[model samples]
Target: MRAAVYRGVNDVRVETVPVPAIGPDEVLIRVAACGICGTDLKKIHTGSHSAPRIFGHETAGTIAAVGERVQGFSVGDRVMVFHHIPCGHCYYCRKKTFAQCEVYKKVGCTAGFEPSGGGFAEYVRVMDWIVRRGLVKIPDGVPFEQAAFVEPVNTCFKAVRNLALEPDETVLVIGQGPIGILLASLAAQTGAKVLTSDLFPERHRIAAEFGLRHPIDAGKEDVVAVAHAASEGRGADAVILAVGGNALIKTAMNAARPGGRVLLFAQTQHGDAVIDPADICMEEKSLIGSYSASEEIQDEGAALVFDGYRNGFDLTRLVSHRFSLEDAVAAIELASNPGPDSMKIFIEPNLAQV
Candidate 1:
């Protein structure tokens, strides 16, 4: 089988490798479509982690075979793979902080080193623990490309859930990238007045099409002022920081009302960021950070993605480009180069059919 192997910094190659062998409690999936995530780009560019890993996590595929002990899932089931599932008895899980559980850090329901999730190949080995708890079956009529969105959508769902948004409240989602747009769309479903901020005019336009009431171009307009005006001078009830830049966190803080909450949905790493501690102290505002999704929320998130498609979430519009596994280099380059119009980029492992 051929897989895109990450060798070193700025290096990924489609090389022939031995197909993964399934354990007695595992299942094997024939890769269908895997989305190129921002984390993949960060890993490649920053070299924050070790190499020789397979980098994809947003995956959708069909089951090729199931281990002897795997039940309920047959050889022909369509599925979406989740890389991490928290141990139900962990301290973090006990507190409902599943993403921080010790077992949550274990990767590879299907691919790459340490089981972090290696969906960038032609096939993946779904480990026993994942088969037992995290794997989800894709319903009939759902396309593989759409199913591939479940993981990311689940992450956003976790953030929105943490926000505990009210129907009449206003939400200001900073950054209109794929994740930002997703947050806006989900917030809109909650009956919140969703406003989006982005440097690109194209993203702002896209947000408007997704039912966003107000789209602020941070490059050309004051995001704080726009958010204030949209909320009738009081500022939004909540601000969702969907972008990872250090500066956006401060912008999110300023865009919220006095007692509003700010949810940092991105920023996987710690970095120097400026914030006024007095703002939280005096104004009584709150800043919360949300990370990975949980097994409990995974099903909810998958249901949300499926329902979004059923109710016309316009998810496919988020995909601006598609690349084959053979064109992995080009895909990475495009994802790295942000223009006025780029959104989500999909990589089809089975591009021959597409």
Candidate 2:
């Protein structure tokens, strides 16, 4: 089998590696489609993790082997695997903060080397705990490409739910990338008037397909002014910072009403952000951060992705490029430096089969 092995900082090499061996309580999945996530790019550029790891997590594929102890799942089932699952009895689990659980911190899927997500490889070994709790069967008639979005959708869904959006509220989503679009679309579903902000018209055009009408040209127009105008000089009811970096944090804070909520969805790095103390103290604005997926809403997220597939929420339309396993390096380059045309980039190991 071939895998894109992460060698070091800003270095990923495609090399032949052994097909991972599964345990008696594990399962094996032949990779079909794996989405190139922003976190994957972060890890590659930052070298936050050790070398020789396979790091694609947004994965969906066909089951090639099932452990003897695994029941209700067969060898031919189509499925997607979550790399982390929390122990239900932990302290964090009790608080519904599953991402903080010690068990959840451990990666459970691997192709070889350290147990980073192995969707970049041709096949991945799903560990015992993941097989029991994190494996999801794809519904019939849903494409593997759409099923690949379940994990990302769950993360975005968790973030949207955290905002507790109201039907009459006005929300400004500060970005127009794939994840940004997902956040804006989900916010729209809550009946909130969604204003999308981006520099590229092409991205705004793609967002229009999801019924997002309000667009703020971040490069030309004052986003904070646009957000305020939409809400009658009070700023938006809520603002979601879907773009990365600390640069936009101040803008997001200024775009929200005095008492409105602001969600930091893409500021994953541990660094100081430019924020006014008055925004939270004097203005009574709330700045909250939501990271990773929530197990509590896993089923709901899966249903939205599966059922939405046929109900006109075709996520595949977001897929702008698909690369074979051999061309994964090029795929990473494109995803790392996205153009106005590139939306969601995918690396399909078994491209012909899919």
Find the candidate with the highest TM-score and give its number. 2
lDDT of 1 by residue, 230-272 (tens): 8889989999998877777878889899999999887877778
| lDDT for model 1 | 0.85
lDDT of 2 by residue, 257-303 (tens): 99999999999899876789999999999999999988899899999
Q: Model 1, residue 196: displacement in angstroms?
A: 0.6
Prediction 1 TM-score vs. true: 0.96
Question: What TM-scores do the predictions have?
Answer: 0.96, 0.98
Off by over 4 Å in 2: 352-354
